[model samples]
Target chain A: MKYLRLVLRSFLRSKRRTVLTILSITVSVALIAILQSILATLNAFANNPDASNRIVVRHKVSITNLLPTRYADWLRQQPEVESVMGLQWFQGVYIDRSNFFPNFASEAEFVNTVFKEEIVEYSDAQFREFLRDRNGALVGKNLADKYGWKLGDVVSLKSELFPITVRLTIRCIFRSKRPADELALHFNYKLLEEGVSYMKGRVGTFFVRVHRADDVPKLIERIDRHFHDAVEPTYSETENAFQLEFLKMMGNYSAIIQMITGAVLVAILIVTANTMAMAIRERTTEISVLRAIGFRTSQILAMLMGEGILLSVLGGAGGLAIAWLLAGAVRGYVGTFLPYLQNFHIDAGTMSLCFHATLAVGTLSTFIPAYRAARRPIVDGLRSL
Target chain B: MSGEPIIRLRGLAKSYYRESLEIPVLQGIDLEIPAGGYYALMGPSGSGKTTLLNLIAGIDRPTGGELEVCGHTLNGLDDDELAAWRSTYVGFIFQNYNLVPVLTAFENVELPLLLTPMSRRARREKVEEALAHVGLTEWMEHYPRQLSGGQEQRVAVARAIVGDPELLVADEPTGALDHKNAEEIMALMEGLNRDLGKTIVMVTHDPKAAHHARHQIHLEKGVLDRTIEVNR
Candidate 1:
C-alpha cells in the first residue's frame, strides 16, 4: 500500500504521457477487436451455412451448359432424393446504372421446397402465380426498396447474354436479417427458359434437399452414378463443399485472416512496449528511494510490473467495451460483403493471451531500466541534486 | 573516547579500490562510544569521520573490524539482520535532514517505526512524544519544503529518537544551517541528550556546534585524538 502511493504519484505526475500511451493502447486494441469480430462473423456464417443439407448439380463443362431438363425428373425418382430444383445465374443489371444485386433464375415450383432454409416468405398460391406467368418475379426487400419496386410494379433489367431487355412484375418481396438469402432476387426460371438462348431442354444446376442430413454422402454417390455416363456429365456436391471450393478460389482466406491476427498482436506489442519504456524512464528517483527504504530489488521490479498490468487492463477493457457495443451493428451492415460472420468476443482465451502478452511487455520491459535503477549505490542515489 | 562503552571497534580497516589498487582510508584503529553521552567528532573533508560514522551506524560493511554495538558483534550478520539491527538500535540523522519529499513531517518520522511491530495507536503516541521532545509539536503535518532549516533538522532529530534506538548518529548535522538556526538545532539535540539521557554522537566541522557536546574528538587521517572534555 505504501509503495502503491508512490507509484500512483509518479504516474499522476506525468499525466500527458500516460494519457497518450493509454490512448494508443486503446486504439490498437479496438481496431484489433473490430477486425477479429468481422473475421469471426464470416467464419461462423460460412462454416454453418444454411444449405449444408443440400447439394448443387451444375453442368460439368460450365454453369452456362444447362443439364437436360429430364435430369430433374430422373433425380426425383431416386429413393434417397426427396426433391430437385433448378437455378441459373441471371447475370443481370437493374435499369438504373448505380443499383447492383445478384439475380437468380430459379424454378418457382421446387425452389422454396428444395432450399427451405433460405425461404424468408411465400405460400403455395404465390408459388403457383409466379410459375404461371413468365414475367413474374420475387425480389429481396433490399433490392425491392433500392429500386422502389412494389407488388405489380414492372421492373426492367438488362441481360448481358440475351438480346432483349428483361421485364418482370414483382409478385412479392421478402426481407431477412439472415444473410444467406437476404439479398437475392428470384426470377421465374420457366420465363428465362423461353427468353434466353441455351442448349435445349436444359437448366443451370440441380438443387437436392435430402430427407436426412446424415444420408447426404450415400445420396450424393447414388445421384452421381445416374449422371456418370449421361450426355451432360454433372458435378454434384454438398452445399458446404461448394462454399469451400468458392473460398479456395479466393487464394487463401485462412492465411490472410492469420496475417491480420498477427498484425494486430504486433501493433499491440509496439504500443505496450513504448508505454512501459516511457513509464520506467520517468520513475528513476522514486524507484531508487523505494529500494533505499528497504524494499528489495525484486519488490521494486514487482511495483513497476504491477503498474503496467493495471494500465493494460484499463486499455484492454476500454477497447473491448467499444467492440461489444458496435460489433452487432457492424455485422449487420456488412452482411452482403461477408455473409458468414455472426459475433465478436473478447473471450477468456483471447483475453488470457492478451494478458500474457501484456504481462510480458510490462514485466520484461522494466528489466533494463529498473535494473539500471537498482544497481546504483544508495549513497549515490541519495546524493542526487 | 569512553570509560564505559556502548559501541566498540578494534583494529578497524577500510579500503577504496581504484581498479586493482586498494587505497586505504582507515588502517588499524580502535574506538569506543559510551552510552548516554553527548560526543562530537570534528574533522576536515575526507578525514574519514563520515566513513567511521557509517560503519558505526551499520549502514556500510567494514572490511576488517571487530565492531560490537550494544554487545552484539556485527561481523557475521547478513544484510537483513544488519538492517533489523539498525532499525531497532541505531538512529540516523542526515546533514540535509533527508525527510522524504512526498511525506509530511509526521509520516517521515513514522518511517523507521514501520520496521517495528508497533500498532498504529502506539506508533502515533510515540511520534507525538518524539515531536514534543524536539519542540516542534506544531510542525507535525508540514512538509520538509514548508519548514524552516532549523525545524527540518528538529524533525530529523524527532525521527531519530522516534525509534527509541540506543545510539543516535548524525553526519554534519548542522553543516547547512545559519548560526542561529544551527544553535537552535544543537540546543534541541543537547536537550534530547542531557535531559532524556539519550546517547548522541554528532560529527561536525564547526566548533561552535561542537561546543554543545560534553566531549569532543578530532579525527585526522582516520585516527581519533581525544581533545577537551567539558562538563556543562
Candidate 2:
C-alpha cells in the first residue's frame, strides 16, 4: 500500500507509451468481447426456452426444398405428437428491405396450440377473428410497434422468392415470453398456398408439438422412418437441433469466433509485453537503486506485475463498456440476416469470461519481463544509464 | 571515538570478465574499521575505490576472500539473506544522490524503513527525525527535482539513516555538488559519525571531502597503497 504512489508514477513515466499500450489493449479486448457476444447471441437461438418440447420436420434434401403438406397429418398420427403445423418461410419485404422481420405461413388451427407457451398477450376473440378470414394475419407485438401497425390494419408484403404479393388484415398482436420470439409474423398457410403456384399444397417445414420432451427424439425417428420409403422422404429433429443444423451451414463460425478472440488476446499480450519490457528497460537504474536500498527481488517483481495488471484491467473495462454500448448498433447491422438476434446484450457469462481473459493476458504479458528485470544483478542494473 | 571493528576484510578480490577474459578490479585487499569510525577511500579512476565500498556494503560479492561486516561473514549467504542483512545494518548514498525522483523527501526517507516491521506512524516519526537531523525538515514534502543538489544529497543522507542502520556507505558523497554544498555534506557526514555513532565508509576523488574523515585509505591499480590516520 505504501508503494502504490511509486508504482503509479512509474507506470505513467512515459505517458504516450502507456496511453498507446492501453489503447491497443482496449481495441483488442473490445473485439474479443464483441465477437464473444455474437457467439452468445447465436447460441441463444438454439437454447430458447420455448423450444423445449417442440420438433421440426423438413425435406430430407434441404430446408429450401418443400415437404408435402400431408406429412403434417402423418406426424400427427404419432402417439407422442400432440399438435402439428405446416410452416413455410415467406421471405418478403414490406416498404423496404431495411424494415425486415420474420414472416411465416403457418397452419392457422395448430399455430395457437403449438406456441401456447410463447404467446403472452393475445385474446381468444382476436384469434377467432384471425381464423374467420382466410386473409388474416397475426403480428408479434414488437413487430407491430416497430411498424406502427394496429389491429385491423392491412399489411401488404411483396415476396422476394416468389412472384406474389401477400395482403392480409392484422387480426391479432401477440406478446411473447422472449423478445426474439416476439419479432415474428404468422399468417394462414392456405392463403399463401392459394396465391403462389410453387408453394401450393406444400410447406418448408412442420413444427410438431410433442406430448413429452423425452419423446422428441423417438418421434423424430419414427416420423422420418414412416416417410423414408415415400416419394419425398423426411428429416426430423428437435427444434433446437434443427436450428443448430442451420447454424452449421454457416460453417463452424463459433470456432472461428473463438480463434479470432484468441488471436486478438495474443496480440494484446504481445503489445503489453513489449510496453512493459521497454518500461522496465528504461527504469533499470531505478530498479537497481531500489535493490540497493534493500528491497527484495520478489517485492520489485510484485510491483511491476501490479502495474501491468492495473493497466490491463483499466483497458479491459473500457473495452467492455464500449462493447456494451455498441451491441444495439451491431444488432441493427446483422439483425436482418439473423432475426433471432433481437434484444442482443452482453450477458453475465460472457462478461465473466472476458474478465478472466483480461487478467490472464495481463499476467502472461508481464511475467517473463518482470522476472528477468527483477533478477538482474544489481551492479549490472546500476551500470545501465 | 571507536570500539571493536565493524568491518573486517581479509585478502578480498573482485574481477570483471569481457567474454571470458578476466579483468581484475580489486585484489589482495585487507582492511578493518572500528565501530563509529569515519573513514574515506580515495583513488584515481579505475582504482576500484567504489568497488571496495560496494563489497563492504554487500551490494557486490568478492571474487575470492573473507569479508565480515557487523559480525556476519559475507561468504555463502544467498542474495536474499544478503539483502536482509544490508537492510538491517548498511545504508547507502550515491554520487548522484539517487533518491527516487517521484518520491517526496519524506517518502524517500521512509522507503528503507518499509522493509522493516515498523508501523506507519512509527515510520513517519523516524523519517521526520532523520530529515530534521539533516536540516531537511522543511523540505520533507519536496521531490528531488524540487530541491537543490545539496538539498537532494541531504535528503539522500536522511533516507540512508532513517532505518538507523549501524553502518553508512557512501560513494562520492559530494561528487556532484558545488564547493559550498560539498562542504555542507561533509559536515553532515561528520555529525552522523560523531553524534549518532554511525561507522562511515565513503569513496571520493576529492581531497577536501576526504579531509572530513578520521582515517583515509588509498587504492591504486586494485591494490591498497597506504592507510593514513588524519589528525583532524
Highest TM-score model number: 2
Highest DockQ against the true fold, candidate = 2
Write candidate 1's Cα lDDT for A1-385 as tens digits.
Answer: 6457555655555678777766766666667666655555445555655676788888778766878888888788877777888877776778553455667778777777786776657655666767777888877676666467778888777876555567888886765655545567788777777776662467778888878878888878777787888888888888777667766666777678668767876776667667667666555554544443444556666666677766666676677677667666664555434444423444555455555655555555545666666555545555563
Q: Every prediction's TM-score for the first chain? A: 0.82, 0.95
lDDT (Cα, tens digit) per residue for candidate 2, span A177-238: 87777888989989888998878888899999988898987887888898899888999888
Q: Roughly what TM-score does model 1 have, to 2 decimal places? A: 0.76
Clashing pairs in 2: none
| lDDT per residue as tens, model 1, B18-94 | 99998777766687778888888788877777777777777666788688887778888875676667777877777
- Poorly placed runs, candidate 2 (over 4 Å): none
For model 2, what is the alpha-carbon lDDT of residue A148? Answer: 89
**How high is the CA lDDT of each candidate model?**
0.72, 0.89
Best candidate, lDDT: 2
